[model samples]
Target chain A: MHIDTGSWHRYMALPAFLLFSLFFLFPLMQGAVLSFTDWDGFSTPSFIGFQNFVDFLHDARALQDVRTTVLFALGSAPLLNLCGLALALLLNKKFRGKQVVRALLYLPAVISPMIMGSIWYLLLQPKRGLFALLLQRVGVSGQGNWMLSSNLALVIIVLVNVWQYAGMTMVIYLAGLQAIPLEHYEAADIEGASSSQTFRHIVFPQLIPSLKINIITNIIGSLSVFEAILALTDGGPGYDTESLSIYILRMCYGNKTGYSTAVALMLFLIILIPVFISLRFFNKVEER
Target chain B: MKPNTTIVADARKTRLSPRNRLDWYLLAIVVLISCVAIIPFYLLVLLALKSPIGGLAAIRLMPDFHFVNFITAWQRSALGKAMFNSLVMTAGGVGLLVFLSSMAGYTIARFPGKLNRTIFTILLLCMMIPGIINTVPLYTLLIRLKGINTYWAMICVMAVNAMPFAIFLYSSFIRAMPVSLEESAIIDGCSWFEAFWRITFPLIGPVTSSVVILQGLGMWNNYAQAVFFLQDKAHRNIPLSISLFFQQYGADWPLMAAAAFLGLLPAVAAFLVFQRYFVEGITAGALKG
Candidate 1:
């Protein structure tokens, strides 16, 4: 194997660049071009000249979907972060069975959200579901299927998502917590600082960086939630739980490809705006 | 101390005492929360074992004591076939992802040239782009390319999705490694590719394992992409099989539960077998960088 460094570098980079081009870049460019036209996906796309964008702008239903998507993201992201932080705090203390608890909590994060949705669907079924039956046994009668009602459907979806994803956030936070010097906490205690005072001054101050990445990533991910929403609600009960991803999916796959492309582009911008802001925010924090 | 200040200090000390009854109360509350988390999973296991027809009628806080449902679900759903398909796809996808990602990573880390940095930045930016934006176009493109109802379509998508993260991890790990190893190998007349294979690759065993396990579990349990791509029932993967199991046996809670449990096997097994790597893989970039 008479090998040279320079030429080998070229060979190494070649396959990866080609792969990315074929699989990633080309389709993205094609998607951008197609977004401008009316294509049913099967037929040749006719030039529509911003008609899709105009149609998307006027679509009240799409606007509502945007609201619902934001609601889901806002509600779930904070709750997940809090739950993760709380768990990390508790688990950071020396305890028996800590490893087992960590493993169990992280289990749901590894499973696909689609599978989790399916499992929860069966478990949360109103009439014959386990929760329903259990509620009956407890003498607390409930009226409607949780998944059927618009308000409850949104809440349940967010709660299930939090449960599934909180573990990963917890792991990240725990790592952050570990990075904090133990001596800092000790010094705070020596200064007669109360637990809450120590948390505010020492723990929370140090958590800013983790919060920056965790909150931004989780919110971006929360807005783009599609698999679980599709499997569980299918944006049903009249588009109550219809996220932008689901909205775009219905447009792209179900009925209107052109209109959906516009909506998808909007969803991209919505995701991008917050992410850009968050990145800037994080940079500012780092610089400080 | 003065009488008034002494009274206030005594009250504060009582409140702040670590061994107070309030501490026990808080512990109880936390234990209660943990129980709530555990009980549902316990019930799921019990539900999976009960007889379908007898299960709902016999629903209780505890197991109904029927284990045959597992056998029936396994027999009826062709779970074995689905598992085989999932394993094949995961193995193929992770295998290619590791090799390709590490090569690019090594070049970027070692060379650090303008082109490499620009490409790396592009990748890092692409990492933030939502996968949904790519889906509609990717699906249509696949259909046009006649890749529907095929594993290749699913494999390609999963591999590409895993690429950015894999490269990110590999780049960080390679950069952490001393360049002295590569330089030494170069002096021994080994080429860059050969040096990477013999030296750099060996050193990255832990990270490589992490990538394999993390991506492997993800691909194993992946259903959304598979559902869209694999139109045939016989060709559907594990998660889809579990989903179809629900649709078919909606009333049969035991069978559906059993099938879901079976569907969780590979993911559970992967997590257990490579638990350390899984944790490292997840917490690496977020925590360290």
Candidate 2:
């Protein structure tokens, strides 16, 4: 098994490597080059290095999108981890109908973002939507146009994102929770450690790795928000819910492919900064 | 809950243990959170079955006995054919991914070399390229290859885009496995490829299933790239079709609700049927990350 011919070795890795280079790497390089040029779809792209990015920087809507993207990522990721941790703690214990509850929580995630957003679009449609109708059933006015309001739109988008994804973090934390050694808790108990003391001393530190994983992923996913926001608000009520991805899509439709690519590169860089920092910081903690 | 087998029972044995309690408070919290999570899905089905009088004016918990909305969505959206396209795309894409990456992963794990290591690292880095960034370039590449609007184009891209994580999972699982099984097979006059096919491949069942569910669900729910590549209405996937349906029926809330449910049906059904694999796969992927 150890003595493999050079031909077979190449054979084993050829398909994946070929596919990756052609589909993933080549396109990325193309995007990189495209970012520096001016092309409006049909016309030939002319070299305009740094100009597209310069324009993007000067663009107020693009800047607002960056702000919105950052806010969404910041608001959603932390709350996702917190709610997930709480749910994980709650579900970690043996309980009746545990699987049913877990499946229910995860159901939202399985639904496509477009569908989820559309459902919420109906539910939050101010006057005669599900929420309003339900509220009216209880004799409370659901009169406010939820998605039409700029301030509430971004908040709703972020909340809907958090709602869909918290279950994933919960499942992660549950896995981390179960892997905790039973003897550690027994030892803490024998030492007469109180409930909060047991959790603080024995559980919290151990779940840090899980928390780190959830945070990084939630950050990446939320920052890439597009379909849901598109379906829900279409960045409407005036750019309040316009994320970077949605901004890029809208630009592409406006025949500003080069600029959109430049914007995408910026968004990509913005997403990476925190992910790398969190990963490095957490790896250090894990080592300790 | 178990008579003598659970941590709960053990906790109950400790007189002053906080875990000794029935944890009703925790259960209530879990139930409430689950309700919040599930209400949209619940309402999706409920409203789909019932007719709306005036742009979603009616709201009821009980599902009406009618599925006229379903028929309307299906016919108006041409969803049946579109769903077929999506199913084919997912199967072909995920199948290609699992097969190719598993072989590559096994090779990488079994054979230790600088080339393989560099390749794996490079593959991991490829994912950092935000997906939207690749849209235009990939489209250009597809056009150059005369691959635009073809099923294979989408399938290949899906397989390749998702290959990094599939390789990650496969290689990780393969690394954790003992080499003795493959070694014995090779010693019995089986070729290395034959040994992998017969032995090594069979042993990596959990990770393989994980790859299937993760990538399968991903492709099923994928909409953005499909919108970019599959421009023809004849070739649109389920998510795209549903989105199109909603746009056409912008004011028809009940029909839109039905379309959304129909689009979500495949993924939701997959999750329910393979709930165990989905949970295990997600948990394992998270931990590995």
Candidate 3:
């Protein structure tokens, strides 16, 4: 049952190299090149240099999209990770109806964001939705036209993202929680540590790995958030919920390709920062 | 650890007591959150039964159970073609993804050296590059390739986006697998490729199934890619068709809900069946960090 690793590596490496070059490297390099140019689909790029980048900074709507994207990333990332961590902590203990509760909690994660957006669009319609109807019953008029406003729509979109993604974050946290040796908890219990103290001492330290991943993913996803917003408002009500992706779609397909690529470049830079931060942070924390 | 007498006594008291006010408070909070997650689908069904105009006038708490709305949406929306397109595209994408990723994962895992690490890191970088960031160039490429109207283009894009995570999962799973099995196969005169196909692939089934389930859900539920790539009405997939249904029947809440229900059925079914493994697959990808 003996074999050589050398021949096997030689046999497998070539195809893997080919696949990576074609699928990963080629498109990525081309994207970087395109970001700098004003290439329309038909003609060769005129090599406009840094003009696209300059215009991206000055464009008011593009800037607002950046602002809204940051707002969403900042708002949703912590909330989703924290909420998921809390849920995982609660469900980790012995309980009744725990599986059913966990299933119900995780159900929203499986539903498509676009479908959820449609449902919310109907349910949150002004003056006629369930929320408004209930508000009317309670003597508040106009409780439902929330998405019609720009900031409020952004808030709601963030909330929806939280609801959808928290299930995933929770599952990852649960795995991290389970992997924490019981001896640590027993030691804490033996020391007569308060629940809060034990959480800060043991659970918080152990959850760093999962938290790093969840925060980075949530930030990146919220920055590029599109399908739900598109299905919900089409970035309407004066482009309130328009994210970088929606802006890019408008540019590429909406006869604003030049402008959209500018937006895309900004998105690339924005996501790149968080990714680098996450990598550095995770490495440092893990080292300790 | 320093033992605190008073804290120990309080902990014992809390442990001895079966139920507490705090536990009740926690239970109530959990139930409330669960209800928040559950109520939307119920309301969607409720809204679908009543007249769209009536529903627009005032929200009804109870569903009218108008199943006919689904039929109406199906007939008017060209949902049949959309479903067909989605099934074919997802199947094709999963097939290609499983093929390419397994080969790459096999190479990376078996090699376990500098080149492998480089390739794996590049794949991770691929994962971080949000799909939208490349839309301009990708769209241009599709247009130039004249693949805008074809399912093959959509399938290729999906497979590429899917490859990195797939390779990651497969590599991790394969690395954990004992090398002796492949060694034995090779000793029996199996070539390296044959050893992978005969010995390695079977052992990787659990992870592969999980990948298939996850990617299948993603490809099935996708909307933006289909919208960007498929211009012809006849070429549109289910998600795009659902969006189209909304456009065509903006006033018909019942019909739109029906269309959504149809659009979501496959994914929801897969979710229910493979929920456990799907969770495992996700944790594997994220926890490696």
Candidate 4:
């Protein structure tokens, strides 16, 4: 097997390496430097030496956005997993037209979240929405729009997010489910194990891989929540529901490029913590 | 013998009765949940079908089937142009991604050299880093390169964003394949590069489709970057155009819904046609890696 090592095949990675380095790696490194300077996205940037990071510590709005982002992730990640696992279990049975049902469930995820948010807004619009109209028909009146409230709007956003993305989680979980050998279920049946027991003992352990993927992704996705909030609330009710990602965008456009870049880095750290924790947790679980 | 037969029949009857009831209950729940899943889309359709005379209050269970709103949405939103832009970018991005990543994957899978291993590690690590951190600098760089709103720039940006996952998928897939296929081609007077293009590349159609379906959809529905890069109307993709249209026509329920629906059609159509690959792609990419 005297295949030549010095050949054109050796340079196969060059194009992708060049493109990714130019577009992704170079900007990321530059962002690290830009975060410490005072750049307004126009004009020259001067070294400011961690001022942006210090300001983020004292900024009330930035702190509040961190809260909102964390709250959204806390609410969204679990519900998405719970609902997705439940859906996977429900749809795991053998039946006619199952593929169609699976596709229908996944349809929401396929559409852009921005459009999905708009559809939800249309259906749940304050007084003139389809829901309000339906409520009026049923003799209910004078109910305030919950979307106008701060906490409730966040709750609504969480629910809408779970609704849109649970199917994605379920698809992954479904793959994990389908991989479990039929013999395991038969063995459980022979042992007279109940459904819950079967799940805890057999299904749950095997599903750890899918859980890791879903949880880590959900954490990152929820933490960086953007278009959904943008389309739904526009981080409205006095910026009460603004996420860190949305805040970063606003700051970048609001003549705070250096600070926004710093905030973006902070968001990356926030995402990293939960993901790291879960990875460690899953490593322990897999070991056990 | 008669008593034994009667006893067996009795046991069968007991098992069948409860199983039948459970099946019916499961069906009921499935249908109920499916309705909840579908209602928002149903509402979108209903509103899109209604005329402007009645607004949201006039929406009903059945669509008015106005049909004219789609025409108006098409004309007013200039969705035709947006679709063209989206298609071109998606096609270009996916094509470049497949070309670049497939080659990268082949080399990375076949070779465990220090450079290849390091490149793979760096890519996998970058996959976890939030892209938002790069937004500010990337935007500035795009401006410097005169790349904003250009197809090549947008395509390159998207392909790079998707590079890691595509490479991961391709590498894992190629690793599982027998190397003897390529070895035979090389023995027959083909260089390793030529062998890859002629033999290996054609053989990995499944991976190619997976990459295309998975990343192509993301490129089509791209908003976060497009909002920053494609500010001009002429360069707007589907999501950007629809979002802008919604902002301008927030009060026009029928027209807004019409625009939304038009934007959704191509994605829905693509999904329906290629959904099998879609699911398989997600499963393979996630679990195998």
Candidate 5:
């Protein structure tokens, strides 16, 4: 049957595309134009010509947030990959009630990060937290709050992020694992290859597709970390742990609309660089 | 085959013993990891069930079964209304997303014309661009459109956010399917649009279900955009309501826990029921995309 190339069927994409353009593309383009102006969310607009971008370079808080955001991604992404890959490997074998165990491991990821953060806060809230209460039951006392320290709070946020999302990464990796033909393993065994060598040669190469997906998504998710940090620290104790996303949100509402848009674009660039680097790196690996 | 039963038995015993012991160790680690994964949820249940009178100091592994905190939280946080709002928005968003994305995917997969290909490429590109950049301008656009505090507004935004991934899933799934079925229907005098709905659409049920489960859960647990779009008590979704409830009653741990539990219940229930689809959806999307 000859399919019509110029039929109205091509227009099937129109509705979704139009809606996307209206809500996503239109605003993105408008934001691009607004980044150059001084709209201030309420005042008359005037063109600023990269002044906001220049200000972001000099703004100590913004720079620190860039640090916080990058640091969180650096900490969170690799740990997530490691923990997830480990869990996937551990659970890859058939065992009794393996489905139940997998489900339980992935349960937290299904819950909202905000809710998970709140639940964690209750369990870790300094002297009054469940941990502290347990410690008191053991006759220990006077421990300091980890949340009060900027670095520790950031670290805790990174850990929490990994804890929540590792399951997601595991699920993807598990799929990749399951897709491997059993004959590959048998062949490796016949060759008397060590498990480590087999993994490095056979498993790792085949899992690159999954690795690319998880790494890219995790990087994007980590860089734009918002709900977890918002729910945990609210970028707290003096904006110490504010991420670029959180900073942009505050500035958007804090009457720095034009500058916030510029920062938001800067965030896009920040996200883009790492993502492109990784994509290029992965492409090269896949080619090899 | 029946020549050496004793030798066969001895070989099996030696072979299985060490592996059985290793399996036991693996099982123990698996159970321990599962426990660690679930401990925070257990604590959430404990805190949600604890009575407010004793505060956090009296918290323990065992719940007091106060149960009243749920009721109080439901009443005070206005979560009933919030739940309704969440339901409306999630349903509307998922419905719109599935409808539009499936059709778009079908066309892009089958047609692959210049327009369709360009649209697909654009959507993929937009998927990488952060949504935060759109916040300020989108807010202004929403105000101009009078979309703040409205269900349709939230639905459109959520659906649009989910569109690229959904479309990708559908197009890939459809592309893998043979075109003979839809081709026959078209040759039998059905229009392409009619052929899709009659022949191809129903066949893509798995992809549709995956999209629903994945994007539905996202819209339900959405906090980032909901926090911005669904401001004010009247329009608050589950995440926004629970957030505001926590802020107002920060000291009331029991009540706050209860509120959070209420907010998370439907998502947990949905995940439990459709978990297989959830995993399949993520795998299909990530692996294929």
Candidate 6:
């Protein structure tokens, strides 16, 4: 192939670059600058260095939201991986109704998170909740009040997120698992290796790529839990479930765009520390 | 004694959970888990069709199959209109992405230089940063350009959101393609665009499918971005309309369920049509990131 380096080669990338700059580049840079200002999203902005950051530090609710956000994210990552991996393993088999089952499991995933959250909100309400009513049938009281309880609210958010996304990870993991040659497993069987032994030596190692992808993406997704939380609880039960993403929205709607941007930037920075750690960890493992 | 040993070994092999070989117990468990997965959606559908008294509060699983609940929520929220708007946006956005990304990918594959490296690197970085972080300034930028609440604003936003992944998918696929195809065409007096369109474009089936599946679903089901940019009632998509309907029918679970599932109808229909590409798309999208 005699490919020439013509001017049109560069010009071919123009549309992508144009879109990237107009929407992503311009806004991100503008946000960075505005984070150091005192703009209320409307009137002409005034320069106020570090004031937004200072406000983020002093604002107790934002700090609390960060705490709740961490709790939600920390809860979400491991649970999603476990559930997703489990479901993937289960569905990987050649069962009779496998296709139907896989579709059902992914049903929650396809529905809008807003709808899923609201559906769950209804299903978890105290007196009227389906789960609550089921519990009562099994010798408990009325609804369990999962959504209203501060302690349970954050936990519920994690569960709801997992419910909505575990199918995605399961499908991803299924793809990974399918790629592993069956001969390896047959070899393990011929060698008289136990099931757990096979998993430890072969299956787990082969799945690390999928694991890294799921974990990194889930970690980021957990930190940015917004729409579902907003729909589910609205940061209710006294802000026990407010994540930084949700908190920043509250700030934005409160007409403090600069302050919210600063907080969001901080959230991004906080997210980076974990992202970098995981990337390094992933690299080191893959090196082995 | 030998038969007993074989049975013992078989038991050990199927003894574990989650990764267990199938047994009666394990199959039952799988069925139960599948039911757990379906129950919420099942309940949503049943409740959506039930009369007002047979809402979530009732312990019964059956619905009277009333279309009135669907009708009430459907008419009030302008479900059809919002669905049409979402469909148009998704189609437009996905179409634009397929065209531009194929070109970018072609460029990256053929031109292995600093510009390619830089563009690819920046895209990789951009994938990590959520656009929500720039909402304040982005909102202001849209306002300044009179793009707030406009169709162009959302179509462009959705397209841009889908860009990084599209570029990555395309570039990787194109790089792996046989270089001779494009080379032979260009040698035969075809211009770059001409060679790309006739020869190279036909071969990008895999990535184009991924772009369509992933970006199309993304634009269709998105609520957060829509909530931020398309705030006006008339300009909103299905998810936003669903949210409004939820708010309006605060304590009305039957109505809420009906409206919610109605909002999900389009995306679900699309997924059914493109079910094959979806799992493929998710796997590709995740593994690359």
B210 in model 2: Cα distance from truth in Å?
0.7
Residue A178, candidate 3: Cα error in Å is: 1.6
Which residue pairs in candidate 1 have backbone atoms (N, alpha carbon, C) closer than 3 angstroms, thus clashing? Answer: B49-B66
- Give the per-residue lDDT digits (tens) of candidate 2, residues B1-289: 3665777667657644456355667767767887787777777787788765533554557777468989988889898999899989999999999889999998888776887888888977765555776777677678889887789999998998789888988888889999888778767867778888899899888888888887788888888889888989878998888888878888877788888888888888888998998999887776765
Question: For model 3, what is the alpha-carbon lDDT of residue A42?
Answer: 62
Q: What is the overall TM-score of model 4 with all chains considered together?
A: 0.95
Chain B TM-score of every predicted model: 0.85, 0.90, 0.86, 0.91, 0.91, 0.89
Docking class of 2: medium
Question: lDDT per residue, candidate 4, B184-217, as tens digits?
Answer: 8877878888888999999998888888987898
lDDT of 5 at B41: 78
Report i-RMS for every model. 3.6, 2.1, 3.0, 2.4, 2.3, 2.8
Per-residue lDDT of model 6, residues B1-289, tens digit only: 9999999998766543324346687689788988888788787787788776634555476667888988888898888889888888888888888898899888887776787778878887887777677676777778889988888888888888778878988888888888787778888888778888899988888678878887788788888788888888778898888888888888887788888888888778877777777777777766655
lDDT of 3 by residue, A1-288 (tens): 345545655445456456556544665578666667776656666777788888887888888888888898898889998899988987786668877777777877776778777877777767667666767888988654676788888888888778877887898898899888877877787788887898899989998888887878787787788887887778878977788788888777565565566667678889989889888988898899
True contacts preserved, each candidate? 0.43, 0.62, 0.52, 0.64, 0.71, 0.58
CAPRI band of model 1? acceptable
Stretches of candidate 3 off by over 4 Å are A1-20, A254-259, B1-22, B51-59, B113-115
Q: lDDT by residue for model 1 over B12-48, one digit each (tens)?
A: 6654443223355556655775676666667678778
Which candidate, 5 or 6, would have the higher lDDT against the true structure? 5
DockQ of each: 0.41, 0.62, 0.49, 0.62, 0.66, 0.52
Give per-model CA RMSD. 5.4, 2.8, 4.3, 2.9, 2.4, 3.9
Ranking according to lDDT, highest score first: 4, 5, 2, 6, 1, 3
lDDT of 5 by residue, A1-288 (tens): 475634788799999999999999999988888899888788798998989889989999999999999999999999999999999988787677889888888888988888888878777889877767777888988498888999999998998888888888999999999898876876776687877987998899999999999999989889999999988999987989999999888876777788888999999999989999999999999899
Better of 2 and 5 by lDDT: 5
The CA lDDT at A288 in model 5 is: 90
Model 3 chain B scores worst on lDDT over the 10 consecutive residues at B13-22
Question: CA lDDT of A272 in candidate 1?
Answer: 84
- Using DockQ as the measure, the top candidate is 5
Colliding pairs, model 5: none
